[model samples]
Target: MYELTVVVTKVLGTCSSEVPMKPGDYLTVRNGALRIPEGGHICLYALQSLMPVLTTKERRIGEKHSDDWVWRVHHVQCPDPEGRVIFHIVRSGEKAEMPPYTPSEPCPQPQTDPSLADLRVIVEEVRGKCTSGMQPGDGFLLKSGRLYIPAGRHFCLYALQATLPLLPAKQRAPLDGDWLARDNHIICPDPAGNVVLRIERV
Candidate 1:
């Protein structure tokens, strides 16, 4: 991230930096300037930190500017990706990565959806992604971004057992071998990895 110095030569209204800010990218409020994390490309949504599980990130500038640097926005420009013309800044080269947002809990172990393996090889590939992927209420690594399964009563996985009877025709049971039995017990991971069961039909 680039740092901008306050100058008396110019009337600072909403003084910004030379760096073109983006969404998902984060900046820290500092004494003299803001620290913009390098390679922190912005996304439409804010990244989830260990705290504030349900908070939506902000991108707009402060309502009004004051002489006090004590209060400032760690501005994250999450503009409409399709739209052009966001903001302007000076220019600077010094940059580095920002500290990662601490995770509230360790991510779950890797998982697989056997049903996805049935049809096309490509389908399996995508399903495999969703396997290690954060469940509806879990969070883990997803390639570059950290996926957070939203935490709330309304989240889908909160009602998994309720979904099974309605399971689509192609995925009524374990896809591969009949190794997984309804009456007998076997390991089957819930889609989000938050739950694993030695499920029995009884």
Candidate 2:
């Protein structure tokens, strides 16, 4: 898999958090693991906004002027209207192997892990037209690392992508003064869609 680094390129507005984000703050995704600087943190909202395109940005684009959206776009903005944090995603030009897991070994169940919490991600509001036909109260459950959408119900792919990167971190016990620990909302990247989803520990 390709390694991608997300760097904070600029902060147009003050971060709502006590610890303001600076241009040097960054996180890297190698193989499938996330790495952050020691004692460093990235805003959940900012990270969520980048989740939709990080995987695509990891790949090499053969054509420089191709119409591929990933090739054309490089910057992503945090959903916070006040913070306006800008993130730049670029391929590190490195390849990495995903950590090996033995198929024979049983995965740790969520129930067995007292520290892990199941989560419910629900649509709190749709500020603009949602092409997916989503509405307030639409939701899905995350348990034992599996997502379950109710039968006969649907979740928007774009909205779901926005929340995927944060779910694993939210499931674990948050570190002291972690901004992600206090944040519970993620906005869909669609400018027109403006779907807001709330995360709740269940």
Best by lDDT: 2
lDDT of all the models against the reference? 0.25, 0.71
Which pairs clash inside model 1?
1-36, 18-89, 18-90, 23-42, 23-43
Q: Which ten residues in a row have the lowest lDDT in candidate 1?
A: 117-126
Looking at model 1, how many pairs of residues clash?
Answer: 5
- Residues 47-142 of candidate 1 have per-residue lDDT tens digits of 211012111111223444474332242222222243332222222342423333322333233423333211100111122223323232221112
How well does model 1 score by local distance difference test? 0.25
Q: Using alpha carbons, what is the TM-score of model 2?
A: 0.48
Model 2 Cα lDDT, one tens digit per residue, 1-202: 5677777777899866434566766666654334554434556566667776876776667766576777677779988899897877767763422222211222344365677687999999999998677899997776544455654566665677778888989999898999998999999888888999999999
Candidate 1 ranges beyond 4 A from true positions: 1-67, 78-139, 153-202
For every candidate, C-alpha RMSD to the true structure in Å: 19.2, 13.2
At residue 197, give the lDDT of candidate 1: 21
TM-score of each: 0.16, 0.48
Give candidate 2 misplaced runs (Cα > 4 Å). Answer: 1-110
